[model samples]
Target: MNQPKKMALIAANLAFFIIVGFFVYQRFGIYLNNPWTRDGQVRAQVIQVTPRVSGTVIEIAVVDNQHVKAGDLLFTIDASTYEVSVQQAIANLERERVSSKGAKIEYERLKDIAAKDAGAVSDKDMIRREVNYQQSLSRITVAEQNLIAAKLQLEYTHVYASVDGYVSNINFQIGSQAIANQPILALVDEHSFWVFGYFQESQLNKIGMGNAAVVTLMGYPDTPIEGRVESMGWGIAPADGTVGYNLLPSIKPVFQWIRLAQRMPVRIELEAIPDNINLRFGMSASVLILSEEDSP
Candidate 1:
């Protein structure tokens, strides 16, 4: 090889290196500015199933992981006690009604006698009769309220699904004692399912509400789910500025050399979820906001 040939070879290698470096820089910039995030999770509204009235579980209408519709029976509590309460309420209401009727009749008679002759009924006696009638009316109202409450308690004995969802975390079975307002199971709402994507705050400018997105679930990687950006989360728990036990705002020390961009959750509303693909709450997902040209 001659000296000129060696110089020519060096020049060629230099040009190749420069071109490669330029392409690499462009690719890195694209990766950084891309409106996408691997830090996304499938989310849904979880309905905690709790009974308003407590009793022994008599029957379990649905099993664990069962799909149920709104108003479907989930389980039944022993309603014997509630039924007795209803009967007692009804009897009390009847007694109050009878007493109120008698008081009304007596008050009317007293008023009529007083009207015929002022001296026939004493003012004190007439006032007393009116008081009695008012008290009876008040008692009747109380009894009616008690009856409604009893009926409400009876209705609580039959637990029903509040939303269309899959039953999860079912711990109570037949014969298990359920406490009032205590959660026995959770229903993950199917229709309320959405993906929460945490993107770098710096990349949020490219993401707008209603922007089309493509989601790939970890479970169903081959099937891309279509969605739209619903909204951006306005707030997140602060990592550094929390109140300390000493009652002062605790600001965490930061390293001046390295700064990390905060992640903001972007809500993605799924378009048409495929029937074949099942979406589970808290499932891992990857989401990408499509550029206008890429969106179908």
Candidate 2:
């Protein structure tokens, strides 16, 4: 063929391939930008067991990594002190009741004597009886409050689990002193688990709230957990420190550095989380967000 004819044939083939490529891209081409897989830590609900009242530990029931149900026995403080307080409260309450009853009887006697026109119980005596009755009523109220407080202290002696979860690392032992606000141990909820994925800021446009993503874990990589975007966090890292809280880079490049993308953690709630496997906190996971668009 002539030189011009061969050149024309080659050009024609290139044009045809370009057209086909464009058509294919329109149908299935997706633009993905700045692909990275940072390590993801598994998050779980942690229960911090703390003492409500100051006491001496008498019974340490559960051990480290022990599973417990709601209202299960966790420990017991010495109830001897609380039991003595309860007895005192009960005695005071009984005394108040008897005094109140006696006041009522005295008031009734005064009423009868005054009605019979006897000076043995004068008007002053009736007035005194009325005052005593009111005083006795107030005493009874105070005794009732004391009784309630004593009963509450007794209940605090027996510690029970507030949540159903697997236990870990019991800090207290029998004969040890435990005070209020002390963290006895921590329990990670095996039933509740989710993943938090940090995606680049560039991917934000394509990924909307409710987009489906496939989650694979280092623990169970074969089992892909399907999840959807539950909600986008409002507090994104600031851009330029003016739009939000953006961290200023510590080191600046002298070679006219290009702008780098920032990553935001997107909380993903699994569409269905099965209770088959224990998903503890700080486990590694990888998620690939299924997107129709390549680069946002």
TM-scores of all models?
0.83, 0.74
CA lDDT for candidate 2: 0.77
lDDT string, candidate 2, 178-246, tens digits: 787888878787667778887777776767776776677787867878877776655674533343236
What residue pairs are clashing in model 2?
Answer: 31-294, 31-295, 42-283, 238-244, 238-245
Q: Once superposed on the true structure, which residue ranges of model 2 sit more than 4 Å away at CA? A: 1-39, 118-128, 236-260, 274-276, 291-296
TM-score of the candidate numbered 1? 0.83
Candidate 2, position 149, lDDT: 97
Name the top lDDT candidate.
1
| Deviation in Å, model 1, residue 183 alpha carbon | 1.6
Error at 34, model 1, angstroms? 3.5
Q: Give candidate 1's whole-model lDDT.
A: 0.92
Per-residue alpha-carbon lDDT of model 1 for 101-147, expressed as tens digits?
Answer: 99999999999998899899998999999999999999999999999
Model 2, residue 142: distance off in Å is 2.7
Give the Cα RMSD of candidate 1.
Answer: 6.9
